[model samples]
Target: MADMSVAAPRSRGLSLPRVNIRAVVMVLYLGFLLLPIYWLINMSLKTNSEILGTFSLWPQNLTFDNYRTILTDPAWYMGYVNSLIYVVMNTVISLTVALPAAYAFSRYRFMGDKHLFFWLLTNRMAPPAVFALPFFQLYSSIGLFDTHIAVALAHCLFNVPLAVWILEGFMRGVPKEIDETAYIDGYSFGRFFVKIFMPLIASGIGVAAFFNFMFSWVELLLSRTLTSVNAKPIAATMTRTVSASGLDWGVLAAAGVLTIVPGALVIWFVRNYIAKGFALGRV
Candidate 1:
């Protein structure tokens, strides 16, 4: 036997790193999460009769009539416009008010500052239903009912606090030396905040804006209570699809699908910033 010892089989270098169990698990979890959304899209393209009478993994009779009606009808399309208006307004207002508040919390040591911060977070903890009646009564009495601004303002009650909390985390990570340096350079407070500080925390602002927009967009109770005709959001509009003849499932599904578009777009645009913020633990 040539040396009576065959060379041991060459090692395969640690068995070629095993498949990542965590990655496989995450992919399965995501697929499970998205299955219902896939079903909704599938239903949107089918007739209401086809939807109710059969159960299929995919639409058998796909059609675009549901989407066509939504696009062509003023009542249907205007709901999207109304929703966008308030959502944008709410996002802007929340970020505007929260930026200053967060800066104060993060950079200063005022009396009762800790208590105040706790109080602000408490507002976010409260349920929207708790304030619905009061909001309705007040907005109605003030002639602000059924207006876009009414919903936007009402939403600020919640969004502002959350925005402040998120922004405070980001602002704290920034060095106070920068503020002093800007002041030394004779940069006005407003100019420094807008031009320098804001850009430094662009990721935080993006995260905050995305949160504000999404909450205001999908909110049903507050938006519904705040508006009826002129400012009725797409969510409220979807309710009209129900009638004596039963639900128009196709149209309703289409509307629901459309309602997700703006939010999806906002997320897509801000995704990179959001990831950065989260990575930094600032969101």
Candidate 2:
């Protein structure tokens, strides 16, 4: 006891070196990630003239015309709205279907269950190109092509499997005793799931939703192929900026910058859930 105070300072001093090294590593990694984002912002601010004329690190003039064009133009802004519609619809559909399927996988074990689970995940591993022609023909025959619902449903082919996998992991982390106790208390399965199981796995749902939104948001291949001009996505519109004449670098950069907003909004809303969802030791 007499020497405890004296030893405390020495122990703390030893930790300082490790802390400093961690801090340095974090700073370097953050800089590496932020550098490219900084470059995009810098390019977005610069005019077409400045972009082609000079290799300047910073623009001599900053203009809002790019952002302005995106906001003012119906074709541009509507692309964002169209993207949001499909992304939200896809996320909702995927999560709803995944929650029940994942519950089945986690709470019950049956014949060939593991094989079925792997098969679900295997859908995710399939190349989008392989499904492109079949998807187009399928959507066309059903008269669902060129509609937002078509793309939303198409995205579910991949997103549902992913959502199921993520939520199943989270559900597996919950103790079986909780379900047993709830059953013993005379709670119906529906009541128990809605009240107890759902709250426990809420974080996982948010995390899964974020992933669905991100994947569907940035995906070009399926979104572009499934829809014609009326339902075309922002990614499809970006192609129009380039032609035989030349690329409209300003509008294109502006469009690229604008595309990041929906993803950012999604992360901002679900960031808290993401951290908690990844935590260990629940089971």
Candidate 3:
């Protein structure tokens, strides 16, 4: 061969690693999405003077007074407790009502079935502002105003419809043969639904519960309109940060951060169910 083969290329002293375009894009997208949340936390750590006096990325004068005030003050901590109470109530009530309604819609064909489904969705689409006055007056007249139940019931107007819609899609995906099989096996409707059918649609229930909780937790107009001192939600109580001394930026930011924690925890726990719900064409 007379040494005709070319020698391998000599090693370079330095070489830049190839950049992953997708990873870079993902990092940038995450940064963009998280910037506001990061800023809120940053503001929470700073004093009102530091927050207003500077626009630094990190707090120059870090303080925990805002968090301390929220944790120590009954007005603040009770707002969080009130919010949780109503949100849990609404989620339970919505799922309880929607499950049967969804099953009926999925398994049966009846007059006005489709029309009724659409009507339910229309209620979800309707503005809360439209019913604010009515709900306020109704709750007040019935002596239900400023109670946890009032906010829970008010939220059901929207959450129940949404829960029904979502659960109906999931229920429709289940085979009708399962119901027939259960019947043949002597399983009563209630027993079959509770023991067999409910498990099959558990992911749907999780998705519905997550949405219902989030809607009820974050809904301000209805919660605020329906409640005052006794059942004031965190969303309503957050507004109290504004007073004669001007806006309490630090406390407001701290409250917002705390408010996001519950919904974030719910999403974390049900993330798998949410993914499955979407995959099942029910989200």
Candidate 4:
């Protein structure tokens, strides 16, 4: 009787673990997070009249006129080019400066290294507003105002320290013995770093590059403040979409959507490195 009772419940037990509550919760959370993006995309394809005429979970009448306007206008299209230029420039400059600094901090002990590292990071903590006037004055004096380099240099004030901090953490995870062995093999400092050490920490570099790109891409205040006609970023141009005629909500949403594409691509490309960084305790 007891054997029969146990066997009777075995089928019921078999189905209990099949439902993954964790996966369900994650899916719900992802959907919640994605709802705003979906709404924005929905709005971008809709006419201003349609948007105001009804509440919608999706566009009733899909249109591409908003994208057409942005693509055709030189002023509008140049905003994206200018933004991309500065963002790429800033990421390059930040990574170039941070790598050696990070290596020094990670591999060597120097006077007040801790104090210096802390001070560098403190630069990132200060609000950009505090330096906006100073930066404007400096760039104006140097004839870099209204140029892509101006925005890139201004952003460096923040991106450099962040890059250094992240790189330093990743560098510390690499064993010092590798450096010694490379040296013993007659590899010079620069050669060893480029050919060996850099590849060893490739994941860290990917993560750092991803971060630098993301920060510079999204940062508006410095980019907008430093640039004008010659090198105006998309964020600044988006504001001009508003005129005496009122706002172009569809075009604005479309611009916002386009801005997200580059960052998303960067994230997707570096996803493996990000995961590896986490595994190595570098993130």
Q: lDDT rank, highest first?
A: 3, 1, 4, 2
TM-score of each: 0.89, 0.88, 0.89, 0.90
Per-residue accuracy of model 2 over 1-283 as CA lDDT, tens digit each = 1233357445666687699899999999999998877777788888889999998888789988888988898888888888889989999999988998999999999999999999988988988999888999999999989899999999998899889988987888788999999999999999998998999988788888888888899888998899987788888878864563287677787788788876777788877566544442132
For model 1, what is the alpha-carbon lDDT of residue 215? 79
Clashing pairs in 3: none
TM for candidate 4 is 0.90
lDDT scores of the candidates, listed in order: 0.86, 0.84, 0.88, 0.86
How well is each residue in 1-283 modelled by candidate 3, as lDDT tens digits? 1122377775644433434666788999999999999999999999999988878998898899999999999989999999999999999999999999999998999999999999998999999999999999999999999999999999999999889988988888789999999999999999999999999988788888888887888889899998889999988888865563389999999999999998888889987666655443443
Model 1: runs farther than 4 Å from truth? 1-20, 243-245, 275-283
Higher-lDDT candidate of 3 and 4: 3
Give the C-alpha lDDT of model 1. Answer: 0.86
> Could you give candidate 4's per-residue lDDT for residues 86-109 as a string of tens digits?
989998999999999999999999
